[model samples]
Target: MWSEIIGKFKGMPSQEKVVRLLLERGFQVDGQGHVVSGRIEIPHTQIAREVGVDRRVVDATTEMILKDDILKRVFMNIHSIASFKDVAPLLGLGVIIITPDNAQNIGILNDVTSVISMFNLSIRQAVTDDPFFTDEPKMTVITNDVIPGELVSELRKLKSVKSVTIQ
Candidate 1:
């Protein structure tokens, strides 16, 4: 919602990155959104370039997002973008979970489960609290779709799986 601030620094390099990063971090749509690093400062153009878009596009995106009644309500304060970093994927209309383990497992799980689960989902960090060392070895899974209980029951039948509990 920092569309005005973004518009003020329009045409600057990495403009998209600054606004996107800020929005991702949870800053609201307002002048206060400009106050990121303890001051009303604009980020360098490199940020926009890194995100592969110019500043104007980022500004426009911010404005469009701010106009939404839902977004305005969600980010009431022009807080730092850092707060919203965890919120974007949620906008994808799917459930998400954090495992804190290997990114690869999450990837594989997607391929395996996408067919069964009709919902669109994406994965990042492992959702398992301890993907590595648990009471026993553990694996984390993130999915937007619901898996059939029978599948889980079948997997637990494997010898390698000590126990199955959906965290």
Candidate 2:
């Protein structure tokens, strides 16, 4: 569905760059065709710079999204999420990064979390990148305390996990 949504701007490569940036950052196109994060408007210049496109290209992309009902609905409701991956270690929290052999594999999150629970470690947050959007999607789990070596060993042993990094 995301591919189809983005494909809408297939003919316009500049607009496609804008759309990919918007989707990756969870930025939304408001009714007035403004790029926004919740109620806060993000300058079109910033968006344009991020995607290396002209400001007009960002404006046109939002305008196109607003014109389509499906795109408008999705973008209107989209908002950015705060990731704890950067701050976890500073806050003395455990950070576990699990790169799966295949992001499409189901139960990766459940399986990883189940193992963490077995060690009585509480999860602060679990976030996974969309496989379709990312070249290599990995799951980052922030736990209440530093992950034990035993847990890391166990996680690495999971059949679905390609690699496990404990921080």
Error of 1 at 166 (Å): 25
Candidate models: Cα lDDT each: 0.44, 0.91
Model 1 collision count: 19
Any runs in candidate 2 off by more than 4 Å, and if so which? Answer: none
What is candidate 2's CA lDDT for residue 33? Answer: 88
- Name the TM-score of candidate 2: 0.97
Worst 10 residues of 2 by lDDT: 28-37
Clashes of 2: 0
Best by TM-score: 2
Q: After superposition, how far is residue 19 of candidate 1 from its true place, in Å?
A: 7.2
Tens digits of per-residue lDDT for model 2, 8-43: 888899999988888889998877888888888999
